[model samples]
Target: MSDLHELRIERHIAAPVDVVWRAWVDHQAEWFCPRPWRASVEVSELRPGGRSVVVMHGPAGEEMRHEGVYLEVVTGERIVSTDAFTAGWRPAGPFLVRIDEFAADGAGTRYAAVARHWTAEARDQHAAMGFEAGWGAAADQLEEVVRRLVAGG
Candidate 1:
């Protein structure tokens, strides 16, 4: 991960690693995007070269579809996907590689999400798009989702 081309949002979540891992992948739609922007996973194959499409719906009927392929998926640990390719390894407009990691921390978990861009300009583009605030708020929502999951909701 290059400091000049990566944006990250990490947090210490008060939940077990498995719970956080589920929220990060299995129940992604619940907290994938910030509020006012809901997400729906169209496909989640969870394997190397598997397709993963998450469509984010804006409050005003706008839709931002993120279509990509999983480069790697480690059960209960991490997910690495990239928009540089869609399903079947076909090329697409390159954006970033998205990495979500969960590690056991005492009785809780440490979660980190990174957006690795191809260039400094792309990194700056994401930062200009309120990456910190948006991703940070989404992280908070993720924690809430984990809590709800633990409560058997």
Candidate 2:
């Protein structure tokens, strides 16, 4: 795919990698979507070829379900998931592969998300669908969740 088929967003979270990772995997429902849109994970298996299903509920009670499989999972470091395939290597309609990385940065963690689309047109469509604003807002919410968790909330 071309470079235009990828979208990336990074954030410096004021928490450790473990803290951030926990928020990502354990507390995803708390911060997965931007405000006014809640996310619920119907299934989550943090291992290669594992299945994951998440539903995002909008303010107006609209729901969008995303189903995918984990391509790679590394504790406290990285997670790669894709909608291009499901568990057991079953082929599915192509959407995007998302890579989430976390690492130590100063006393905090540096987190990044890279979303790769199958086609540049899809990437552009995602961007037009608020990829930057929506994802960026979700990341900010994630940082808040991690910070609160680390603070013993």
Candidate 3:
């Protein structure tokens, strides 16, 4: 994947890995998008070849549904999914493969979300689509969710 065009958001959050992972996988709807935007998860099986469907709702009453299949999954550690194929191995227009990783960093967590594009053009398209700003904001939201999880909510 080194040669693939990539975009990523990395953070050293002041929260435990368990809390971060829980917030990301278990509490996705609460923090999957930036403020003013919301996400609805239709299917999140968290296993290899499982379904991963999420519909993002924009503040302007727009909805963008992302449907994909999980390529690999390692609970509390890594998740790799791609929209190139949906559940049941049906092909679709490919864009990028999303990889999410979490690791313990002392008492905190090291988190990274990466998007590997099929081509430079696709990568540029995603960049132009506000990937950095949008993803960064979502990461901030994830931290907020982590806070709630840590506080036993």
Write one digit per residue (lDDT tens) for candidate 2, span 1-153: 467489999999988899899999999988888989999999999999899999999999999988899989999999999988776778899889999999999989999998999888899999999999999999999998888998899
List the candidates' TM-scores in order: 0.95, 0.95, 0.95
For candidate 3, what's the RMSD?
1.3
How does each model score on lDDT?
0.90, 0.91, 0.91
Model 1 scores a C-alpha lDDT of 0.90
Residue 8, candidate 2: Cα error in Å is 0.6
lDDT of 3: 0.91
lDDT of 1 by residue, 1-153 (tens): 567488999999988998888887777898889998999999999999899999999999999999999998999898999999988788999989988889998889999989999999999999999999999989999999999988998
lDDT of 3 by residue, 87-153 (tens): 8999999999999999999879999999999898899999999999999898888998898878888
Model 3: residue 68 alpha-carbon error in angstroms: 0.2
Which residue runs does candidate 2 get wrong by more than 4 Å?
1-4
- Number of clashes recorded per candidate: 0, 0, 0
Instruction: Quote the lDDT for 61 in model 2.
Output: 93
Q: What is the C-alpha RMSD of each candidate to the true structure, in Å?
A: 1.3, 1.4, 1.3
Q: Which ten-residue region of model 2 has the weakest summed lDDT?
A: 1-10
Per-residue error at 98 for model 2, in Å? 0.2
- In model 1, how large is the Cα lDDT of residue 150? 89
